[model samples]
Target: MAVSTLMFAICTAIYIAIVLFLGYMGFKRTKGTEDYMLAGRKVHPALIALSYGATFISTSAIIGFGGVAANLGMGIIWLVGLNIFFGIFIAFIIYGKKTRQIGQKLKAVTFPDLMGKIYNSAFMQYACGLIIVVGMPLYTSAVMIGGARFIETTFSMDYNLALLIFAAITAIYVIFGGLLAVIYTDSFQAIIMLLGMSILLIFTYVSLGGVTNAHEALSNMASLVPASLASTGMTGWTTMPSMFSPIWLTLVTTIILGVGIGVLAQPQLIVRFMTAKDDKALNRAVPIGGFFILMLPGVAYTIGALTNVYFYEKMGKLAVAAAGGNTDSVIPLYINMSMPDWFVVLFMLTLLAAAMSTLSALFHSMGTAAVNDIWGRWRNKKPSLAETKAFVLIMIIVSVLLAYIMPGSIIARATAMFMGLCAAAFLPAFTHAIFSKKPSTRAAASSLVVGAVAWFLWTAFVHIKESEPLGISMLLFGQNAILPMPWQVVDPLVIALPLSIITLAAVWMVERVTTTKEEDAAEKAI
Candidate 1:
């Protein structure tokens, strides 16, 4: 049943008022750049956990990748396990603690601050900020697309209008209140997300009869697998794709490993650790974040896969075909067709919250990177509150422009691309900052430059999409990819990450050997 216009209006009005109110509160409490960027470093455990978790899981996970699961099958559930183990547990327990300790030790306010201070190099800070400014909007654009698409579907509104409204509202709070507003709103949004997803889980089971019955029905869908997909090694909705298959390569390397492990180096997430009050807050946040991480994606992937069953029964077409082969549309169409009107309205808000929470973080991270790290280095001074706020508005405009211009069916791939790029370019240096001291400015610079260049070259020459436009591969190899079939489909991370690590190791070794020789010569002369 369609939602009554009255209910829709009431729900929307309430949600908007609450969002604005929280922004006001954040603005009232915020006093300076520190408060704007790091929430004054006095945030509690629950707020940090929820804010972190909410920032981590966005519409890309709930809607875009969820739709991919519908077509690809239950194997995507592996991402849920990975997200909890790597994204939350390892991130919070290992990386988060160290980041918090070292960040405070260095008076670091952003990821760039942490890196630059650890290495005592201004270039590291400036380069890191430039990268975030240039690349993070891709990720932010994905989040905006997710929320805007949902609003478009739910209200039957124009996509452009939906996109603008979503961007504008999120920009309002983030611009005025800064990180405090983002975190405060994020905690509340996380609550709504949890409630919304819990209800989605229950309804999915009820619709499919029961838990066992749902699995049984999905398992029985083996023969119904599309012949084209099966040709590429798709087996059944309940089974994993064939090993070394194209689908398998994309799923394992790109979707699962790319995002799951890449969370370690995400700039926005790293800053969350700096917002906490103490180690106790960091420790206290583990389980809360773990639970939110586990449940949200767990439910999303399950329902995503099961939506195939729902669509198959109602329309005789699989989820992908039912949504016109556009994977991005699968989840929204399923919700509209299978769910009641009230639930649709509720889920819309859940998605809106998810998108806004993540976008707020991304925008704030980008703004701080620009004003604090990049501009501060140029000026040899810290950014004032007004400068930070102005940059936040600039980032919002950049992200909105990207969202408007980005291709359709790109939300998931864009998410993966940004995450993969961050992992490739930032992970080695970021890890070294905490775990090793031998990496010099040269090593950091070489690793970052090599990692970023390798990833871009691969994408532009070897990857299918950008390669078409750039024609680097076509010019050099007379083909869209220089590699053979299996290698061609492999994600950039599979290549770039190893190269990044090796560069870091090689430079560090050279620095050590060079220093030792110089010291020996000085000693002999003495």
Candidate 2:
């Protein structure tokens, strides 16, 4: 125990030193709001790539979802494919350049600013900001829980204490240095994660014989799949489930489609586009971002599946205690028990780096959204620099409190909720703004109201198992009961996104026809 504690302390000191150094650099560079919020809008391509990758792949991916992959088998690999194709390829290549062009055109600093300027509506800006402020805490809490859970498992520390300590440290750096510090630290953290996961993957494979033997072992344990899952058309990890069953629906719709499509609409990520030097910078950064995003999650999830083999061989049962008798503990337990002490120390640092990188980005985004989007508008004049700093501090405090109070199993659920909300509320308006010449204000407003209400209702009442209707989803159909068919099981995004697009188009058509008739009457009268 003394050795383990000493190892952790050394690793922590090294990690904190690096973070503080980056924060100092950011502080030296920060001269104004623009510098603090958007890294002076001159972030290098490589750092942007690293920042994007690090933010996208958090402890939620490594520890939380890694556990999910371990329990669920190789089926979770679909998530990695989605991350590359949608999160990186489409996001960076297609959306990234276009978004940068538009954001620069409008001088938009925050995601809410982009929406407000594109729609020419302060209401939309406030609405988007409110959604972020309310919804982001859920995600923040989940990440905190993930890091805390890992620490608690490995070091036998109090979960609450772990959560508080992690949140406090992250909040301090982010509140002080903002986006530049976050990006600099994220680049460094991304390196640690890549190296750590790669080493773990190699070690786990070698320790449990070889790749071929690991596959054979996993194949032999096909019977271990839950009978209920099998009945729902989920075969073992070796094969895909049926096309549209619950397991397939959950995997494809919620995990894959939800997160994949949702990446385009992620505010923290979208803001990265604005930080790039130019279109050339964005273009150059795409491949680097894609590589890091693909490799880290790819290795982590692959190792997750292989943990079953490790458990069976070591414990004679396909279970690890850290996971609370669940499969999610498979990765953490494997690292703690299977790897050498030095590697365990390395893995802990990797996890800490992952958690802090993500938290810093998240807090910075939230603070900017609150200060630049919501509070700044209410001020008759621009706020003083001190006021902006105060707002950042307030946001950090709120986020830290939320993290401390969050439940343990909220990671996946919170992720889905935020992604789903972004897809429903922002996707249609954003698409129309970029593609259409004369997207009507009425259309934009109608889309926001309809999409936000529909998504809230569906998720809160109809779709979720026991949520109260009026709580959020009550606006849809004015009922507190669940909907039937795909709505019952499908993610709310599937319904709300299409509904928003259709509503926007319908409103535009009506407005166009009305204007045409009015113009014809004026010609006749003249």
Candidate 3:
């Protein structure tokens, strides 16, 4: 190996050694399923905050959505605001305390477990678990792609090898040490991410001669937008697309709104609340989480937009054009070409940290969901730690296969797709479970079915981006989509989430009326 490659390898080895040491510490502390799944429910506020933030902002946020910003321009900034406000403020203050209290009260160890206990029905657990097992791999795959892309860029390694290695390394701790290991390592990764992102923003601004100059340079290139994008409604890097245009709807409904509101129902994110020791910990986490959120996505999006300016000035090409048409490559390409060698190594570690932190949490959640809700329910027993480990290994392989099969330039879209489905399927039922005095199982069930089905139907038929590739609509309807313009561009979450909410409300009201009448009529001599 070259001297530089050898030095970089040494640094990475040291970092991984530290992470493994922390994982071992977690292993030593873990005494039972509770400790493995919920970190013994005594995590410090800072650890909780960092773990949550790190898990929330993965490689998908940095490399994937950052690349989206490069393609779609600064308009992607809306997502950062929603991430902080809805994902942090509303989530911690409104949902965290309730989830922590109720989870403790009912001895719920997983998200599905909490739902099942809330409704006094094992079916709730089974349904939620099935969703996680089936749907989470798409997201997990996308995150792996983000990490592998950077590793491929950094080490000049084969994409397939990078993906397998990334998957295997991230799986080790999650398989053996479970959630506690995930939490400690994720917290450490979070600090790395903060430093990396902070330096990235600084370097980007300095390269472009400070913030104002960068924004102006990007703004001045409005007329340079590609014909395809401009015709679709994109105005420029610094401005929103034309209202109700195809690009505008896609940006507003699909990218921005999809992920913005979708964060509420994410299984991995919600489980963080269950690990909190008390309401005070949750409260203390808010500002810390908010700051972390502001720094990561905020910097990613800002730097992404500015990369266009850098490319235009340096090579007389747009960011996407400079990257040869693949948006996913834009951020990675820019980093390699623009940053110093030492910074490249540092940022490579950041991407690794981002990917591993999120992947560890995802593997832990999926494994526990499989054990506590699906397989364990089938076996009619509390699953052994060995069983959870086995399932974690299985899930890692599944996600790795998915990452291999998924097409290029897919990271952002897949992330949105997963988040949107979660919003449509889980948001209504999850909200009802934690807040309602008596959450209606029938209502929650109906909502889950309708929401998931609606979203799938829309994606497979009406949403052009997905439907065109899936070819389901073509086979059934003789066209890529069953609809024209606007509707084709509208995100499924926009339509399905409302339907889910309405289904739950309607069912709950009907149940309330019938139950009241039945009570008045007496027990019918049973």
At residue 263, what lDDT does model 1 achieve? 89
Query: Each model's TM-score, in the order given?
Result: 0.98, 0.93, 0.98
Q: Clashes per prediction?
A: 0, 3, 0
C-alpha RMSD values across all candidates: 1.3, 2.7, 1.6
What value does the lDDT take at residue 521 in candidate 1?
100
By TM-score, how accurate is candidate 1?
Answer: 0.98
- Model 2 per-residue lDDT at 433: 77
Clashing pairs in 1: none
Report the poorest 10 consecutive residues by lDDT, candidate 3.
1-10
Residue by residue across 1-526, what tens digits does model 1's lDDT show?
Answer: 4667898889978998898899889999998888888889989999999999999999999988988899899899999888889888889889999899999888999999889999899989988998899999999998999888877777788999988888889999999998999999999999999999999999989999999999999999999998888988899989999999988898898899989878888999999999888888988999999999988988989998999889889999899899888878888888888889999999988998999999999999999999999988899998899999898899899999989988777888889989989999999989888877455878888898888889888887776755666688899889888777777668888889899999998998999999999999999999
**Backbone clash total, candidate 3:** 0
- Which candidate ranks first by lDDT, i.e. highest? 3
- Write down the TM-score for model 3: 0.98
Report the lDDT tens digits of candidate 2 across residue range 303-407. Answer: 877787777677776643445664445666778878888888888888888888888888888878888888887673555556666776776678768877655
What's the lDDT for candidate 1?
0.89
lDDT of 3 at 358: 96
